[model samples]
Target chain A: MSGAVPWNEARAQEIIDAHLGLEGPALPILHAIQEEFGYVPEAVVPQMAQSLNISRAEMHGVVTFYHDFRHAPAGRHVLKLCRAESCQSMGSEKIAKDFLERIKLEWGGTANDGSLTVEAVYCLGLCAHSPGALYDGEPIGRVDGEILDELASEAQKS
Target chain B: MTKIYVPRDMAALAVGAKRVLAAIEKEASARGETIQIIRNGSRGLLWLEPLVEVETPEGRIGYGNVKPSDVPSLFDAGFLKGGAHPLSIGKVEDHPYWAKQTRVTFERVGIIDPVNLDDYVAHGGGQGLAKAFEIGPAKVIEEVTKSGLRGRGGAGFPAGIKWKTVADAPADRRYVVTNADEGDSGTFADRMVMEGDPFVLIEGMTICGYAIGASKGFIYLRAEYPQCAEVLTEALEAARKAGWLGENVRGSGFAFDIELRIGAGAYVCGEETSLLESLEGHRGIVRAKPPLPAHVGFMGRPTVVNNVLTLATAPAILAKGGEFYASFGVGRSRGTMPLQIAGNVKYGGLYETPFGLTLGEIVNDIGGGTLTGRPVRAVQCGGPLGAYVPPSLFDTPFDYEAFQKHDSLIGHGGLVVFDDTVDMMQMARFGMEFCAIESCGKCTPCRIGSTRGVETIDKIVEGVDVEANIELLSDLCNTMKFGSLCALGGFAPYPVESALRHYPEDFRKATLPAAAE
Candidate 1:
């Protein structure tokens, strides 16, 4: 109740409930556990290995296999600037560079202040906004230096 | 007693739906108004998102893109009593956009509270499943096949054919994997449908299981989509609780179950084979084709790997009958697609129309042109991997064949519009760089070629060996296309090539010859 939704007991049951006695139910079960808890915590990995009757290495392999699962806590805001073709076409390289420099963060990294995490997302479905970006999860288009500045300010207020 | 539906999907929230929800709740109580509000999905009318549908005796009246302050005036206008507000498109059901769209797949999306199962059921959430129980599995597959529903997730593979193959495959354990890893730039239709009508996805997979004689399913959703995943997990549990899923679904002597599989963070995993590999506890890398998942996939068993929209469309295909779906399209592509319209445009959002609508109509008519109010430059159909089309191809229809004729494909139905200010060279480089970063490092072409492609383009941008560097970059993109094992490496060059061809001036202008400069 207090923290990152606890990767503990309730999550353990969610994992247990994710599978049946069928062949190779480990993957689906791991996915379910991670869904309940944002990440497949180091603590839960061992628990899942035991519950799914697989090795911890196997569980770790799974935890690393797909790109959707994450281990670290997301910053209060996840600022995904489109590093895709269209966005990059309209000076996204500069925008991304600016974002990295301004926030003092690299791609796939969070700002030390924990206010923002900058990730290089491919696209936010706003090609017209060439150089698009998503603040938290909402997609915004036509992102220029000015727009980025406005977004940076917006994120700070939240 | 007034009933209202507010969209609680993350998109609506990002645009201040949270504050609006509180306003509606607080104001209704303050005015001592009796209001029953349900949070549904967007009406694809995103310009008017946080779209509030107040129920009337005939149907729900629309009022939205609302702000917290707008609630006072809206209340005064008898909005709490489902009266016509300024934003109200009286008799919301009759709106041309909604009326024209034969939304069998997305029927439950904008109508009911996404997280509320009671609302979902009341709106006929599991009706297909109920009907599925009465008919045999073969009959269900027959209906889907008759519908001519192609996979909406980029590749226009025949959905019925895929199901029939999996259904008839000789395997002890068949698996059904829904590729919900929607990483396309302009494509939120997958996420929107998943978050709005999760039960449709559940019912779809269950029906898929019954069709393929598989007992289990996995929805390999992207991790970035936390909200969608959360709702899906809840819906999965809800389905199990309500006997819509779990052992012997519908007590029809057929057992099937589904679980949400969260992908770590790979865009290439959106590909079916890579998705299958990722689901099977390996790096989200693309697997070789020919053994095509249908014959052998997801743990060396027969598996049906499909897109989220493809699976979501199944329930309706069964409920309304396949012929009903097949009648709507222009060419080989049939049925309605949830077109995700985003970016610099006045009218940006989802438009669920039948296939065959021209790119011109979608961009100029529905999108209301560019947000900058300038003449539109180019529209990128599909995600990063899709092709870029110039204004010349604006008149082309949106079906797979039509797009393919234009050297494009409607990948995931995300149409991103750009104005005159865009440069094509940088866009081309991004295709290479993105593939480079997202590549699983399995093969050389995609893995190394992408990095080189980025470096080569960087040289051009920096005005170093301009023309030669451009040729080298183009050559590298071509090699990556033919030589790479998968589309991650192969098809990435599509955007790069198309950009270079359509807007040659953009690249030449930025990286002009030293003599020209």
Candidate 2:
């Protein structure tokens, strides 16, 4: 009912039922759950499995298999850094390493203050402007340390 | 009223197009001038993004790399009247990057309002469908076959042959599936088509449906492209409202409707069988082929799975006839390929050119060399699964066959350039690491072999048993190449092998023994 839907059995069931009629509803249903609850709560999986007429193992497998599905709530701002070939050519590896070391966090680790979570994305399709990063799902191109630091500080403020 | 065009393509938006659009609006309001603002798709020349165009007496006069702050200045210079300004790049089509391009598929991209059905119709949109209806299904397949159009999603299988097989195959139900899960690193052409000119994809898919006797269609889109998904949904709704799609499309009595299925961040899903598996609500795992998707696909019914470009180009092939389309290409690679130049290149963008141009021309001449102004070292053609080409082999023609001869591939036509500063060993390790990370665990060689590859490369980097480890890595690559079920593992060796062969110096330096030192 609130802006960020809290973990509720009724809400999860509603989301699962909304997509159950589709041909392949597992991924879509999972995506909808994440969209609604910020993350796919472990509690919601069983409910979704039950509604879809599949076992809990099958539902859990689908959830864990894809990289986009978050098992836990991400920080207020999620930073998806591109570590693929195009980005690497423009010094993304160093940028990623330096940023992680600066924040004292590793890949997929949220900052202690809950301001940021850094995840490695294969590519953002912004190859022309390499060393790209997505700040809260909006892409930022030609990324460097200064830009990343500014973004992190801004995220902390928000 | 003066009409101004600003791209809503994600790449353009990434570089402050929204800000520029707002600024233009604000500046216009202040001057009390009435102007029509059109949100079009990008022209694919990404280096000069936020490119704003104004309809002037001369033509659509262009301004490159316009920022929010420049809007007021542009207004002051009477840019609406095509007055000279510092940012003016003249007409967009006259730009050298655009002029030379043979834009068959991308003719309408960045030029028209993406969702405007009227604009699409005005610019040779429905002609393909009209032509397809006139020729009938069998003749449509013949036209596509004669055009020599191949799958643009890396594998250069002829599109017509695939369609013919699906058409001839006896099935109770058939479906047309577009592989819009474009997860390749240096590729964005599919995204461009889906966002900028979504109706073209719709038209192409609908034509495919008519040709193959399919009544249902689906676009297996990636989740990363939220903009494309939104635009495509809007476009599909509009097409349905206009009777272009639904139970009876364009009064032809051919019942066909398309559904959009979003993928949850799996690169392997770009593979056809894996895509079908994902479409069916299962894990995005590779399936062993022999019964290709054309024969047994999408709920075990015959399905025609095609890339966005391959489908989008269908309209032109139908409208202009197959021979006209086939006349542009060299060798077996017919029609124009949208070569996406990316990474450290100066003029990194999409260039749709005919095959037969040497790789050197694409990199040195058209690309204008590295962005760092350093000597070019390596270029990775195609996606992550493609080979790393050294400067020595830059002369190889931009053809599928030519790249194959050099143990490389033009997978999806994405060229990622690297300067001399790149460490080949690091790049090679990344290839194995990426494979390990994205492998679906469907095949043992892909899942385990990729992990072993990463470990072996790490050992090589750590100078552990140097020569023996290299030998082991090669052996592992061979096993994966021969034993793997899909291209995910089979072609993973391309980057590793190419990197090692081309830049042995980097490997030797990383793994040199202390005794040798």
Tell me the alpha-carbon RMSD of every candidate: 4.0, 1.5
Q: Against the true structure, whose DockQ is highest?
A: 2
Q: Candidate 1, residues A41-99: lDDT per residue as tens digits?
A: 77777777777667989878767755545676666677778776545545677877975
Docking class of 2: high
Error of 2 at B93 (Å): 1.2
Q: Which candidate has the highest TM-score of all? A: 2
Worst lDDT 10-window in candidate 2 chain B: B508-517
> For model 1, what is the alpha-carbon lDDT of residue B256?
86
* lDDT by residue for model 1 (B307-353), tens: 88898888888878899999998879888888877666667777888
> How would the docking of model 1 be graded?
acceptable
Candidate lDDT values, in order: 0.78, 0.91
lDDT of 2 by residue, B1-517 (tens): 9999998888888788989999999999999999999999989999999899999888898898999999999998999987789999988889999999999999899999999999999998999999999989999999999999999999999999999999999999999999999988999999998889999999999999999999999999988787788899999999999999999999999999999988988999999999999998888888889899999999999999999999999999999999999999898989899999999999999999899899999999999999999999999999999999988998899999999999999999999999999999888888988999999998899999999998998888887888999999999999999999999999999999998898887877754556586
Model 2 ranges with Cα > 4 A deviation: A1-3, B511-517
Separate clash counts for every candidate: 22, 0
User: Where does model 1 exceed 4 Å of error?
Assistant: A1-100, A109-116, A123-158, B115-118, B121-124, B510-517
